[model samples]
Target: MANDKTSHEIGIDGAILATQVPGNNGTLILSIQQTSALNNWLLKWANYLQNEQTPRNEWLMTTILIKSKSLKIEHKIAGVSPQKIPDSQYQAQGQRVTWVLMAADIQTT
Candidate 1:
């Protein structure tokens, strides 16, 4: 998704700037802005999702809803990881982080 007025108006703002669904396997790549508040939440959320002790299969079936304009896209959670932004791409406004969320299955609606 592009960082346009439409995208921002639809809820994709500073926190989550963009999203991409690669192929038909339901892999989602989220472009997010890093902040102290988000850092705390991301660590806990990512830890829980990445934990081996958690039931992976059940978690994989979880659905995430993304809304933009009049469109609503649903994605299933297969896995997730929080990655740091390279220094070269860092911006003064805030650090950039990529959150990769994989899906167990892809859905079309």
Candidate 2:
């Protein structure tokens, strides 16, 4: 279903993970690599939910990877959905790593 593009769909460039380490001097540590288009898509979806006032149940979660084995991974994006992302789905491409982020339900309370 991801192959099909809609009018609201945003083209993805890449995504990365930023994690905080206890003794890292409060620095934001980033993973090495991320798949292109993932972050962009999530952001687009998030914005759509906000703009359209859609319910959280209408949103779908996803995790995507680059198709090529030879491609280089750059950086990670933070705060993607956990339900869509799993640890097993990632492979560290040498010095490159990946991050997880969330595009979750919008709540007002």
Most lDDT-accurate candidate: 1
RMSD of 1: 14.0
Best by TM-score: 1
In candidate 2, where is summed lDDT lowest over 10 consecutive residues?
A: 21-30
Query: Compared with the true structure, what per-residue lDDT tens digits does model 2 show for residues 16-93?
Result: 444433220111223433454654454466466555577675444332232434665432222234333223335555
Candidate 2 similarity to native, TM-score: 0.23
Error of 2 at 59 (Å): 3.5
lDDT of each: 0.51, 0.37
Error of 1 at 75 (Å): 5.7
lDDT of 1 by residue, 30-109 (tens): 65666666555765766676679977754444466554546665433333233332222456676666666655445445
Q: By how many angstroms RMSD does model 2 differ from the true structure?
A: 19.8
